[model samples]
Target: MSGHVSGYLSIPPLRRDLLIAYLAAAAVTVHVLEAALPGPGPWFKPGLANVFALVAFLRLGWRGAMAVTLMRILAGSLALGTLFTPGFFLSFFGGCGALAMLALLRMIPSSGLGVVGISLLAALAHMAAQIVAAWLLIIGHAGILAALPWFLAGSWISGVLNGLLTYLLLEHFDRHHALLTEP
Candidate 1:
């Protein structure tokens, strides 16, 4: 071997990458556990996993949040045996839509929108994307559009609750763990 070594695997992961991996693992765990809980309906999940995504975004940035989301969806789907199923596709598209909205919102400097506001908008985007996915992939008809209002309403409620929880969690971290306050 040469005196020097240069390989991707040989390189140690950055702190940011480690943080991303930690957040993704947390999100995936929440996802799997949440999937087991009985909800009002298949679409009415509290989306507890998204709380971790929000935390990742705030602490690590959009890319970190995206990593957590992908990990949650993919690993959670595998755990739930929903891989390659309609549920997985719905989740993938919905997550993409939510991330897209978050990216757009992040561009607006000091928009006065707090975590709750951002979460609400993102949740709506997620619901809309899922509806469209349902129409295009499964139903193949406009009838799926009829459920938009209900889905949006549920999403709004879940988003608000999740945002409040995230806010509280962040506040606690800020008070008890100053290290988490920094990116």
Candidate 2:
């Protein structure tokens, strides 16, 4: 841990907040930009912004990850003018589900899974949460369940891509930022 900020607890409060702010801003930018792209469907997104959240989790711990996520959702929603809309809740809840999954996975032994595995699982959780949110909050019909497979398929692909991008980013950080690394 020499000279490295390995975990949330290890960082000075001001520095942690500053780091969270920087990560949140990046996540928000990605979230807003991604929303502008035309997707295969209304709900389909590559979730590129999640790479930052994963980076925060790996380098800064759960609190930092959660901070980035919450900020991204709130600020992204506002930026897109989707606040308090069905779309906003979907993103919010989906993000929460992903964070929850990441937290659970974090409790496991580090060797049990790699970044890609965690990303895949988190993506699935995000989709599942969105599906449930749609069913309960909007559709109110069992027919919505029929779309789960397709949504999960999309999640699988996006998760892998995002994870790989995150891996690359982490590698770069490890090469240059001596203070950032897994706890």
Top model by TM-score, which number? Answer: 2
TM-score of each: 0.86, 0.88
Kindly report the root-mean-square deviation of model 1 from the true structure over all alpha carbons: 9.4
Collision pairs in model 1: none
lDDT: which candidate is best? 2
Model 2 lDDT, full chain set: 0.84
**What TM-score does model 1 achieve against the real structure?**
0.86
- Off-target runs (Cα >4 Å) in candidate 2 are 1-9, 40-43, 177-183
Q: What TM-score does candidate 2 get on C-alpha atoms?
A: 0.88
Residue 163 lDDT in model 1?
81
